[model samples]
Target: MITHIVLFKLKDGIDRDTKQVAEAVAYAREVGHQVPELVDWRVGWNTVDRDISYDFAAIGVLADLPALQRYQENDFHRLAIEKWRLISDWVVADLEDQ
Candidate 1:
């Protein structure tokens, strides 16, 4: 299996309480149902308060690399990226799951 992880940080001068951020968060979670390749998914704001901690996190599990790629190219997945870009910058990592 593969785990696709994303960490999102609000952009400079952007606060987490705005309507844009709230909608993006809701959209991120909703995208899971729209993508067929995801075996599992979790999306939410970070719980801890720390400088090193990002504002949001999304973790998705897929069958393998090909499935992960399909998820990346999915229309809803792309839309979620577009939504996040308006309020924050994000980093992603894909890894094999034991």
Candidate 2:
């Protein structure tokens, strides 16, 4: 299995409560349900206050690299990413389960 994780930090001057940001967060939380290749999906806004903490995070598991690629290529997933791109900078990591 492959675990795909992402951390998002809002861009300077963007309000976290704005419609775009809210929708982006919601989309991130729901994409797994829309994509057949994704399993065990989870996403949320960060509640902790730390200088280095990102504003949001998402994690999902896929069966393998091809599954992960399919998830990335999904239309809904791509739209969600575009929304995030408007308001934040993000980083991603993919790991294989032992």
Who wins the lDDT comparison?
2
Model 1 stretches astray by more than 4 angstroms = none
Clash counts for the predictions, in order:
0, 0
Q: Which one wins on TM-score? A: 2
lDDT of 2 by residue, 1-98 (tens): 99999999999999987998988988887797899998789988899979999989999999999999899999999989999999999999999988
Candidate 1 similarity to native, TM-score: 0.94
Deviation from native of the Cα of residue 53 in model 2, angstroms: 0.6
Off by over 4 Å in 2: none
lDDT of 2 at 11: 97
lDDT (Cα, tens digit) per residue for candidate 1, span 1-98: 99889999999988888898888888899978999999999988788899898989999999999998898899988888898999898898999967
